[model samples]
Target: MSDPKLQEKIIDALKTVQDPDLHKDIVSLGFVKNLNMEGGNVKFDVELTTPACPVKEQLRTECETKVKAIDGVVQVEVNMTAVVRSTEHAQPILTGVKNIIAVASGKGGVGKSTVSTNLAIALSLTGARVGLMDADIYGPSIPQMMGIPISSPKVGSENKFFPHEKYGLKVVSAAFLTKQGQPLMLRGPMLGGIIQQFLQNVEWGELDYLIIDLPPGTGDVQLTLTQKAPISGAVVVTTPQEISLIDADKGVKMFQ
Candidate 1:
């Protein structure tokens, strides 16, 4: 026979464990799923919002430790899984993308693209589906950095572009669309149009996060993204130098 009172004790014990990010217990956040109890053997799954959560193992360990300490509990099994959540009721403009993170800089030479590249890769290492979009039209460097050949993305039906696949990431950049060493004498409106094309017409498929490497400084690409897309967050890259810090300040305020 199942002991309802014992199960209640297990739940209460779990309630003591709180999600550091959500500032609430997992039970209150509806993270505990598929809980099963058989005599003293207890098993359950903890579903997190993002696979890239920094404290994933910590939560799993806490769940196991707490449940095992309960009286009459012989074994405790906790499975960790993730389902990336969107920002509130905001429907993503990118069909299957759950979150869009923009990486920008106040000026050039601050390594914004490099930081963005590593950020996408780090997220992918955590088992999250990640994509990188190089929005730096004038000097697209992600292709060279990522070793992606300068070639246009493959087109699908309805004029949708299939982003280039490289290093477990779906990548897209203007370098693929233009000739090598070609000077793009594009105006502000044209720049905005290009960004919109990349955002709406790319077949990014299902992604937990899409990292956009914006051009150095606030420009057409930044304006288009901020005005059109629901950006979840922004990162400003800069150097320790005062000049770099000054530009980075502008980038931060632009996003804010």
Candidate 2:
């Protein structure tokens, strides 16, 4: 039997575990699940965003160390898994943005949006001129996720559109243009064209970094951006889950 105080201490220790990419505590993000105790031996799940994560071993060690440090804890077992990205999440489209960095994942609900948003905020907090593009045309959520209102951009010369501003960050997304609750009925070629226009025609002005939140999976939009623009690099986001890591590996390959 485990002491109640020991379990509380273990949980408290885990509160210090941070998802390095997302800049949020792992416990708050629901990454630490299923804490079981048996005679001072503890077993828990350390769910991650991607399985192919370079930090897997480090995180596992950190989790173990944190759990073991608690008084009365004898052993620690961390069962790792990856979280998937959800289709309902929207991808942001950036315009006139330079140094594009696509945040991608093999599966949905892996906290890709959370990573993108926090990264943009962190970059901006560092005084870099930043913009976020929601490239997930089918499901756009940058507006809501970032707490920005949905409004159409103003048209300028040559019928170019201007990006909306939020927290000193410029942003553009499908959610900003469509009517509330309307379906986006677009095919591959059409969707690609729209993303192209958002990149080429929008008045993003000058920006140091443009972070793109890509939709889950390998699709036309992702290919279009890679081929159409000069991307600096790609960041793969995944939970420590096997299935998510398997898919994230494919995403890394797609970029390579």
Candidate 3:
């Protein structure tokens, strides 16, 4: 059903296209998938590491150009897709979530929630399964920022609850659990307990990226979350000022 020599030629041509980030050829990275051939027609999928890859289109174009250059190739079909790589967690919590990203800062007013909201939406726009959690107990603002109505997550059997689905993100927020305009008079211990509860009780199923907007500061909220869950990575936001950077440094150190 296929010509051996022609297949070899196609493979060789594809080897010239290297992934800018990984610095490896598509063939070597095993990005080429579902390759099918019929006489002069060649069709294949270019599976990438992340859906939001910066050079997705460039890689697709390069793949098409190289395949079309093959002598016997009369037609070329290259589809770009992504499968996000995940980090290994010691604990089996959030088993279905592939990546858990934390958005943090040293102090308030640094726009941590703003970054988290946009980052989660941006990843979702790339066609990846994404979730957003507002871990800021004292001042939960993700609901308003995401335009998500304040509502409780759906409770399932056995103390589990499903996160609210909106804007292509499975969202959970502290604001959803309390009355509007009411201050959270929670003590230090309660803060950590809530974080653990959110991590263990909420049902965030099969997400490529679960972005958690951590409350500003290196306090109970931060400690509770980091200890209870495996953070794949963190993005610490801050301003150029010395005061802001000092707190940002502390936030970064907390994750380390």
The TM-score that candidate 2 achieves is 0.62
Residue-by-residue lDDT tens digits, candidate 2, 66-168: 8888878888999887653222212344333446778998998898888998888787775567889998888887888888877678999999988888899
RMSD in order of candidates = 1.5, 14.1, 1.1
Shift in Å, residue 10, candidate 3: 0.8
The worst-scoring run of ten residues by lDDT in candidate 3 lies at 176-185
Query: Would you list the C-alpha lDDT of every candidate in the order shown?
Result: 0.91, 0.82, 0.90
TM-score of each: 0.95, 0.62, 0.97
- Residue-pair clashes per prediction, in order, are 0, 31, 0
- Colliding residue pairs in candidate 1: none
Question: Residue 226's C-alpha lDDT in candidate 2?
Answer: 82
Candidate 3 at 232: error in angstroms? Answer: 0.6
The better-scoring model by TM-score among 1 and 2 is 1
Best by TM-score: 3
Specify the poorest-scoring 10-residue window by lDDT in model 2.
84-93
After the best TM-score superposition of candidate 3, give how far the Cα of residue 255 lies from its true spot, in angstroms.
1.7
For model 3, how does the per-residue alpha-carbon lDDT over 83-150 read when each residue is reduced to its tens digit?
Answer: 99888988888898888999999989988999999999999999999999999998999989988887
C-alpha RMSD (angstroms) for model 3: 1.1
